[model samples]
Target: MSHAGDGAEVVLRLDRISKSFGALKANDAVSLTLRRGEVVALLGENGAGKTTLMNILFGHYLADDGGVEVFGQPLPPGNPRAALAAGVGMVHQHFTLAGNLTVLENIRLGTEGLWSRGAADARAKVERLSRDFGLAVHPDAKVGRLTVGERQRVEILKALYRDARILILDEPTAVLTPQESEALFATLRKATALGLSMIFISHKLHEVMAIADRCVVLRHGRVVGEVDTHATDKGALAALMVGGELSLPRAEVRVPGAVLMRLDGVSTPNRGAGPGLKAVTLELKAGQITGLAGVSGNGQAALAEIVGGLALPVSGSIMLKGEVVTGWSPGAALAKGVARIPEDRHHQGSIADFDLTENAVLEGYRSRFSRRGWMNWRAARAFAEGIIKDYDVRCPGPETRIRLLSGGNMQKLILGRVLSAGPEVILANQPVRGLDVGAIAYVQSQLIAARDRGAAVLLISEDLDEIMGLSDVIHVMSQGRLSPAFARGTMTAAELGLWMAGQKFEAPDAA
Candidate 1:
């Protein structure tokens, strides 16, 4: 199973695979192999062709040259159903389940024929699958009611129910907690013991080292290197993938000014739908970044929305710069020198169909780019061009559709636009969630720069590493309650993980 022994079975083999999109060669003459009962980790930067290569193997894309052989037989090009029949299954980052449908109904949609099994039989199989693996989800529960972690388990169950031997998981743990991730890897190990081969795609180095047998590094449309996970360090893997030295942002010294914002016993009732803030009290001072760390589906979004003036708490007051600003609209928040970068970039950060110019003018059109009740297209275009140049956004031109840009580029544009306002208070939510290492470094540096410029920043993220790296004060949010804020370097990750799991921790005593 390791390195494809002479007698070992090869489940997947790609030889001299190449694909081109217009002038850019997404994948170039790449070769790979997946043996039975082995886990391979795919390492690469953004736009490095890892997804393209995986897509080619899964029949989502037709390669210009070379071939994909599954189980020692040639796989048809651009046919996902055929790939599934050949025992190849792909779990995308975003779950494709319908919210209104039950788990069993969603799983049965395209996987099985009506003649194959009735509802009762399907439920029985789902129960067995759930028990067999560590994946537990109520088959009859509506998908909308399930948590993010539960939905992920359902996704894996769907693939397993299809009788897939070879599975490809893309950023599987991107939204899971540390405990949930441990459970998932434990389940994956059990599956591997039963002769399942897998390819895991992720940017988190420590997880890959723990879960994968070996690592394959890709750089700019080509295979650069491969090594055993145990033998190579994360630094080596990052160097190989990024193709250069990695420089991280250095923390700067700053004297934090007076409190820019204070939340006093803020409480929001959710009407029994989900979690909401409860008697939360907090403060954000100028020239410091306050990081809120939590699992994906916790109250991070609610906290961010309330602070950004999108959601108003039922009780308590929000004081900004010594003025009560509770129940203020988003425009009022912006006018009062508050900037917000939402958690979900596509739906909350920017309009998808709009061009870069239009997106750039979203917050500033009324004041900066509008005159006499008319939007000044020339001024807006200039502002967008400035962002494109300053942020290093890679696209066709300034007028290009924002949706057409890659995730990282779109993030850069968003940061550029928000920072251009020079707001005194910032609420950044999951700012660098899906970006690559280079882009992450850039975004972190930008946030730090803003902090050094005397702005009060509220950073809400699921990444403990990010929160630990860039916070002056760190707090964990769980089940709509804010934990006591701990000064930087005062708490360990293990302690924070416990707090994120809803454990109560007493604040450190101040002498």
Candidate 2:
């Protein structure tokens, strides 16, 4: 049966969907409809059941109650094969791609497993699909060599290769630069025009306003509101998502102190994980935010590690507070008052298997929690509890494992642990990457507060808006090289984008 209500086809529908984990009801009688050739934005705060509902739709989790319908047919529960057979596909926030495999191989992996009738036909069809969808990529290129945007395109290609007609994209633009995000939106519109419906899950209110046709707001595991994007504003949508009015904190003006940290011709080895610096020179001063803007993987991670003492520079010297601290270890840097809020919170910022109490003392256990080689579990718990209260980290309790907390909460805990150390320099790498609007405001405010307290802050981020809004001086990194620092409000986002693509922006003085 085809549902052509008002002459538009309903491609997907969920009626009174419910799911629970232990005592927490993640989804409570939720309902939704995704129509053909339309893009719907699913809005919510962290842990508001958006992902839980999508997991149910994709057969990652079995719904305790209610039913899922795809293309006007009820889908069997707890079976991904059935969901895929029904033309449902999902692109997760954390990509599940085989890095060593080629793009085409990854795309056709599960769908055409074991045997193939014609290799030429498969290649030709892949090319045709790439051409039709504006998803340009080298079919034989290694997945690991591709950029974040390229990887996302490959994921979409995989879903399409599996004959998926309805797509669910989870935080699709979270890892993309401004230019890449715009290109993604354009590609999505092209797909929509080809009669494919999409569910775009995102916490970015601006993106929701820009790309969505209809807005569905989720709060506390329930459907709180639904409205046309044209009719609703970001403020109203934000209010509905968090169940309250959320205001962005205004940036404060501050007079920068003397030079505190300097990276004089710093260079690192190209170790295959991130872009290594090529004679990159930079400076950070007290009471100021020195912003480093780039497409992620373009040396931002390397720069962060070099500064945070996780990785030693192969060349050049690092000067901290007028003292030479080259080749210093992480513990050495911590001892010298350097606090790092790492980019990857799961692997670098927090220990997943450990409880909040343990993760809280990961860096400070030697100095704060341990004496005479014996660990003080009670003192660590106390510290963790304080962080939970002060940072407003929403978790079950301090005894809960770090992996069980939401991304935003984990980030909050990381910030709390590092900031509580009373550091002189702050290395905030992608500090608000996956946080909601409210959490973003909190993180930004905290960074500003740190700067106000005379910390030399090195802020590395892919978000151009954030760099422009927060930094006193901005430098663009491209191809492992650093451009000359521009004063606040000196360069536009477009100019930054060009630089991010490894293109030089020749100023009038140089011209």
Top candidate, metric TM-score: 2
lDDT per residue for candidate 1 within 152-257, as digits (tens), equals: 9889999998988999999998877777788889888878877889999998988899888889998989999989887998888988988987866856656789
What are the lDDT figures for the candidates, one per model?
0.87, 0.87
lDDT of 2 by residue, 334-360 (tens): 999988999889998998999999998
Give candidate 1 misplaced runs (Cα > 4 Å): 1-7, 98-109, 113-128, 136-146, 250-255, 374-378, 503-511
Give the worst 10-residue stretch by lDDT in candidate 1: 502-511
Off by over 4 Å in 2: 1-6, 113-115, 374-379, 505-511
- TM for candidate 2 is 0.93
Which pairs clash in model 2? none
Q: How do all models score by TM-score?
A: 0.90, 0.93
Any residue pairs clashing in model 1, and if so which?
A: none
